[model samples]
Target: MSSHLLPNLTAAHLFEAILAIALVFSCLLGLQVIRERRPPAVTLAWVAVLVLLPMLGVLLYLLFGTRKRWELRVRQRPVIGCETAVRPFDDAHVLDRMLRRLALPPALSGNDIRCSWRPEVARRDLLDVIDGATERLWMFIYMFEDDASGALVLDALIAAASRGVRVRVMVDDLGSFGSLAAGRRALEAAGGRMVRFKPVWYALRKRMLNLRNHRKIVVADGQVAWTGGRNVGDHYLAAGKHEWLDFSAVIRGPTALALEEICRNDWRFASDEPPDSSPVWVSGPQGNACLQVLPAGPEYRDDAWQTALVKCCFEAHSRLWLATPYFVPDETVTNAVLTAARSGVDVRILVPHRSDNLVVDLVGRSFLREVQRAGGKVFRYKIGMMHAKAVLVDDTLAMFGSANIDARSLFLNYECMVIGYDAETVIPVQAFFEYAFARASRGVRTIGQIRETLSSLARLLAPLL
Candidate 1:
């Protein structure tokens, strides 16, 4: 054969080899996806993508599809000081029992729970908690910007560290990249340590880029704790006119110790160093409120927080109110919400008119319509970006924390929430919801054809998102 002919033949063989490898990889991925037992829609989507676009599907699966990371789980230390001795299955409240069964901390009474709906109040309380830290301070925040609010908190942390307080900070690498450098250096210079949760480069190398640490927790001296959807930024602190509507809760009791344990576990996971010995303090009931800390992440076999939230929805007899910035719920949660609404429970969902994420906003419209059809009320906040994640069931239970009502939060990211089952906690959350509802416009029961078509298309890609 001629030289040109031989070269062409070699190129053709290389192309054929690539095709065979792609086909084999796609087949293996399809089988693994099925074996993972994901939702039917998600599984089918993955299978179809692999069958049609094998190479791209394989890359996508590696980056975003892989859910479980056994290494992370193995490296994580066991529950140190948060586990309950006896199962609370016979508890009066079904949610309490269910949460205990899921290995969450038991609800402890006598905790003083204070919820802050205003951004400025939450910021002030957080800074005060930091400045008051006499022994140790731990913070696991998703977004720690270098703006005014961040600077203020960093200054507090630096002062605490300078005064011989053990300060440890953990922030998401992707969420707070380059924003924490100055803070970290200053903190470290003052005898503190700061670490990133799943650094971007490391996550990419491990093929776990989608798993983010979205938890926002601050525990000072193991006596007081602050947690909620609010991160460390000017927008969250209401420094500007376009502030995001958010809230955080302060708890003083054994519940604070539980949160501190979570922070320690997270810090250990990110820094690969065992947490320093905790200061010894008498942890007793501080007030009349009962609170439990529910933490969820990919390290666990089941989605504990999602299961609890769905259980709460089904258990709601009088009312169920949810406030989330993102609302792309999965099938189980959607069904729970619809069932409650159909059963004559007052089901109301509050979301922003337009969230910061355009795709999430579009996808959420479809889910919101489903709720509306099931006799649920949808309230779209119009004043500003609603960034709070809160849930109120009946007049007794309230939950608020970092998890959004979306797949990424409920399934992919590390999240934490405080569940309060008493008048004190419920009343404050109810007031927050009432305030938001008053400002929000009711979602229209009808949609135009063009908007409905776009929403329909967006719903199809919801599983991937």
Candidate 2:
């Protein structure tokens, strides 16, 4: 019945076959949209694309629209070392409960936190801690350039490993691939073990490329840890054309254990090796600081860090100061900050005068005037690129981490931050913000002043950036 009919089939039959295939794909995609149960806007957008451009739309959705596969696998498969490392205090608050429910350790007290904006100071602190490492050292960095600054750290790691210390380094595959081939070899030659997280490979899932390990963390002997926006590069530590003005917080006490756990978890995920079962603990309360190490990524049910930051903005009674390198926030984030400013909470955003990303800079420019109109103040740093990601709410809390105020950091990449709830931590962060703000210019011209057509077009494509 089919042999002669297939040969005799005309253009009309071919067209009907193509239409039937498209209908089948469109229906399957619609079923997926309902099954994933994403936000209304996201679901509608996918449906619109599928209806308009059937073939290309299905391909793009399959590549990037799929939920975080790696995250889902990690969450569903319980690793042997996923145990509670810290105990909650008696007076645990709402934030503490929320974090605990997410499988994070309790916000422990008796912690010491130091915030430093000076790159040299932070670099020295990092080196000193590494040099002091006697037992074990673990580092997770997004980028490790093969420059003078990166050499110093790599040399330290090699020396530490040669001296019988156990040192482990995990770098993002795509970000530090060049550096691994150039400078990081010495550390491995000296007996240190280094692993790349999710290395780039052809035919690998497209969603895996975006789900990078963006956390910048270093732990020494399970007693001290350093985390923030600074990467191992000359630009972060020295003054140059593209040098960044960044900050890192040195954490001590029980909080350091929390940071260690994050490193252990990530290392296991990348290497498929069992984490060290030995627990990291402190003697007792080192200081009055109370801190929690919050880790967020696509793996979680919600964007925990983004939700926490927005919650902090709304809860601020006096002032909310946020300084970030990139300022491409989603509508939800923008509205939260705007509502705070409109409600008489003094809101100030300090972004770099010139960002490293041109498209990101343009998108940020589009929001400056609107935020300013809503009672928030926008200041552009007059000096070098400000790469610090920090927020201060009144005199109570100070948070600085690897995540920026951009779509990628908020939604896609894995990020980590230590939130301090004591004055000792907040005071130093506030002081740093004050110092940077003094050098920033308050006379920011709106996007309308800067050329509306280009900026408007950039703003419309913000989701892609």
The superposed Cα distance between candidate 2 and the true structure at residue 340, in angstroms, equals 0.4
TM-score of candidate 2 relative to the true fold? 0.89
Q: Which stretches of candidate 2 lie over 4 Å from their true place?
A: 1-39, 70-90, 239-242, 276-282, 447-454
Q: Write the per-residue lDDT of candidate 2 for residues 20-114, one digit (tens) a residue.
A: 78868977987787676454556787788888877777777766676444444333222232223244444565666767776765677877887
lDDT for each of the candidates?
0.85, 0.79
Q: TM-score each candidate.
A: 0.93, 0.89
- Residue 203 in candidate 1 has what lDDT? 86
**Per-residue error (Å), model 2, residue 330:** 1.1
lDDT of 1 by residue, 1-465 (tens): 598699899999998998889989999999988876677888898999999999899888888888766555523234343334223557647888877676666777768988987888999899889988999899989999988888888899899999999999999999998877777888999999999888988888887789999999999988999899999998898556779999898888778887887887777678868655644444656787878788888776678878998999988999999999999999889999999999999999999988998988878889999899999999999988999999999988999999998888877889998888889989999999999999999985578899899888888877656
Candidate 1 versus truth, CA RMSD in Å, comes to 2.5
lDDT of 1 at 290: 76
